[model samples]
Target: MKLNAKGALLHRQLYVLLKEQIVTGRYRAGDLLPTQEALCQQFSISRITVRRALADLGEDSFIQNRQGVGAFVTANIGKTKHGPDFSFIGEMRRALKETTMQLLLLETQRCPAAIAAALGLADHEQALHVVRTRSQADEPVALLDGWIPCRFAKAVTAEALKTKSLHELIAGSFEQLGRVAQEVNAALADPIVAQALNIEINSATLKIDRLVHNREGAPVHYVTVLTAPMRTRLVMEVAADDIDGYNVGRLLHDVQQPKAPRRRQP
Candidate 1:
C-alpha cells in the first residue's frame, strides 16, 4: 500500500510493487487481484494508472485480463516468478530429491585470484565454476556459486549436480574430505541475486564462505552460498559433553537434556 511513485512513473512503480508481491507469494496463483477502483485508493493513483500497470503485467504474462471482470493471476505463476522460459524448473522438480536445483551455469574457467588462492591453485589454474539455485516448492531459498579445482571437476557434470548436493558430489569424487572451514556473514543482494531469488535489490542476505580440504589438507572446493535472510534459519547443535572447538556463537535455542537435576549450590 502507498507505493512511492514520485521517482519513477507511478504506473511503473505499481507494476514493480505488484510484481514483487506476486513473486513473494502474497498474491498466489488463481488469486483475484483487486479491482481498479481498489488499487486506485490503495496507491492514491488514478484508475488510469492502475490500468496501465495491470496492462504491463498482462504483457509480461503475469495476469489475464477480462473485459468486465478483473485480472487474475495465471495458473503458470510458478514460471512467472522468474520468467516465461523457466519451464525447465518442472523437470528439476522431479529430477532432484528433497530439494530442486536449477543449474544456471556450469563451465570450466580460470579461477579468480581470490578464489584460486582459497582453492590452493597456482596462477592460471582453471576450475569448474558452478552456479545454481536451490528451491523448495518452487520458491528459491539459496544461490550456490562455487569453484572446484579441475582435478576433481570431472565428476561435477550438469547431470551429476541434479542428484546431489555440492558437498555430496565433492565427497563422492574425492576421498576423505578432511575438514571444512566455513563462516557466516551478512550481505546485501545485488542485481544478479535479486533477480535470481525474486527479491528486491539490496535486500538483506545471509552469506556463507566455505572451503573444503582433503585428508592431506589441500583445499579442493570453494563456494559461497547466499540465502534469503527471511526464508532460512541456521541451527547449530553441540552436545553438552562435547564443548571443544570455537565458542563464539551465542545461545540461540537452549535445550536441557540431563539424567537428573543437579545439586543446588549452598
Candidate 2:
C-alpha cells in the first residue's frame, strides 16, 4: 500500500489507507493486520504514526486489538444482519440445560472509582456487587460482575439470586426497567479472572460492559462480563433496519431444559 506522508498529515493518510483496505475486503473480517514494526518498515513511517492510525481504527470499531496479539479486523465488518438482544440468564437457560452459576462473591459496598463512574453512583454511594462463574456442563465459560445502585440493594440477596434471571428480579421490584446499552472489547485476562475461569494470563478475553436502564431512560445498573473467546461467540447481523433498533446480545443456540449447578473442582 502506498501511503502519503507529505507535510504533517502522515497519520491521517495511513488511517485512510488501512480503513480502505478493510472496507474494500482486502483485509477481510478477523484478519490480523501487519504488526506496528512491519507497518513502520513498509510505510517508512515512525512507530508513533502507525500506532496513531491503529488506535483510530480500533476506536472506530474497524479493528480490535487483541492483547499480546496483533490488531485484527472486526468480525462484524460488512455483515448485514443483527441479532435480537435478550437477557443472558434466559438465553443461557434456553441454550443449554447444563448451564449453571457458581457464586464467587456477592456483597454490598461503596462503589469503587471505576464502578461508580460506570453506574453513575453519587459520592459515598453504596452498590451491590455480584460475582459469579458461569458454566455449561461443568465447564467454565464466563466470569460476571454486576454492580447495582444501593437504592435497590435491599431487594437483592444471595438467596434471591440463586434461581432466577436478574432481569426478572429487577423488573419485578422496579417499575420501568428497560433496554441496556453495551460495548464489547478484547482484553487480556487478569490474574483473578484467569484463575477463576481456569485460563492463562494474557489469554484472549471478550470484555462486555453493559449499562442497564429503566424505561424512563435512567441508568439503573452497570455490569462487566468477561469470557474466553474460545468458549463464547459474539454474533450480530448488520442492516439498515438494525439502525432503527435491534437487540445485540441474543445467543444463537439450541433451547433445552434447565439443569443443576456443578460442584467445584477439587
Candidate 3:
C-alpha cells in the first residue's frame, strides 16, 4: 500500500489499513490474505516491512499464519461507532447498571478562588460543594468535585445526588440551563485523588474542567474531574468537514495504490 510520508511509518500505516479492512468485515475469518510478494508489489514496500505488519496483526489476534501457506483472517474485532453527543453525564447514566456513585461530601461552603472565578463568584462567596467517586465493575474510575452557586443549593440534596447525576439535578432545577464549556488536560494524580481512584500517586490521569452556563450566558457551576486513565477513555467522532483538509477517500486510496518508482537519471 502507498504510505503517506507525512503520517506514520510505512509498516504501521500498512498495518492500520489492513486492520481496518478486517475489522470492517472486508476480510472475513478463514479468508487467506494476499501473498507476501503480492502485498509488497501492490504497496511498493519491502518484504521486511510487510512481514512486520503481518506479524503485528497476528499478535493482535486479527490474523494467523500457517507455515508453507499464508496469513488468514482469524478474528473480527468490531468497533462501536458513536455520534456527536459527548456528554459525560449521559455516559455515566447509560452505564448505571454496572456503575455506582459514592457521594463523599455535600454541603455549603466558601468557594475556592479558582472555582469561584470559573463560576463568577466574588471572594468568600458561598457555594455548594459536592465530591463524589464513581466506580465501574467494582473498580474506582473517577473522582468528581463540583461547585455551584448558593442560589441552586436548595435544589440539591444528598439523596438526590446519590441517585441522579449532577447535570440532571442542575437541569431539573433551572429552566435556563444552556451550554457547557469544557476543557480536558493530562495531569498527574495527587495523593488524595490517587487514593480515591486506587492508582499510584503521580500516575497519569485525565482531568476535565467544565463551566456550565445558563441560556442568558451566566455561569452556574464549575466542576473538576480526575479519572484513571486505564479505566476511563474519551472518544470523540467528528465529521470530515469538521476536521479541516481531512479527506477520507484520499487517505484510503493512498494506501491502496502502489507508489510510482523514481525515474533513473539520464
Top candidate by TM-score = 3
Candidate 1 vs 2: which has more lDDT: 1
**What does candidate 2's lDDT look like per residue over 151-223, in tens digits?**
6555667687777656556655334566667878889999999997888777769998888887766667788
lDDT of every model, 2 decimals: 0.78, 0.76, 0.78
Model 1 alpha-carbon drift over 4 Å, by segment: 1-97, 173-175, 239-266
Measured with C-alpha atoms, the lDDT of residue 11 in candidate 2 is: 88
lDDT of 3 by residue, 1-266 (tens): 45665646788878878987887678888888899999999988899999999999999899999999999998545444344245544555565656788889998999888888888889978999999898876899889899989886666888877676676676663345776667778899899998899987887799988788877777877989899765576665446565644421112233567789999999
Question: What is the lDDT, from 0 to 100, of the residue 71 in candidate 1?
Answer: 93
Per-residue error for 213 in candidate 1, Å, reads 2.1
Where does candidate 2 stray beyond 4 Å?
A: 1-98, 173-176, 237-239, 242-266
lDDT of 1 by residue, 197-229 (tens): 888888778998888887778787898989986
| Model with the higher TM-score, candidate 1 or 3 | 3
Weakest 10 consecutive residues of candidate 1 by summed lDDT: 81-90
Measured against the true structure, the TM-scores of the candidates, in listed sequence, are: 0.55, 0.55, 0.56
lDDT, residue 170, model 2: 60
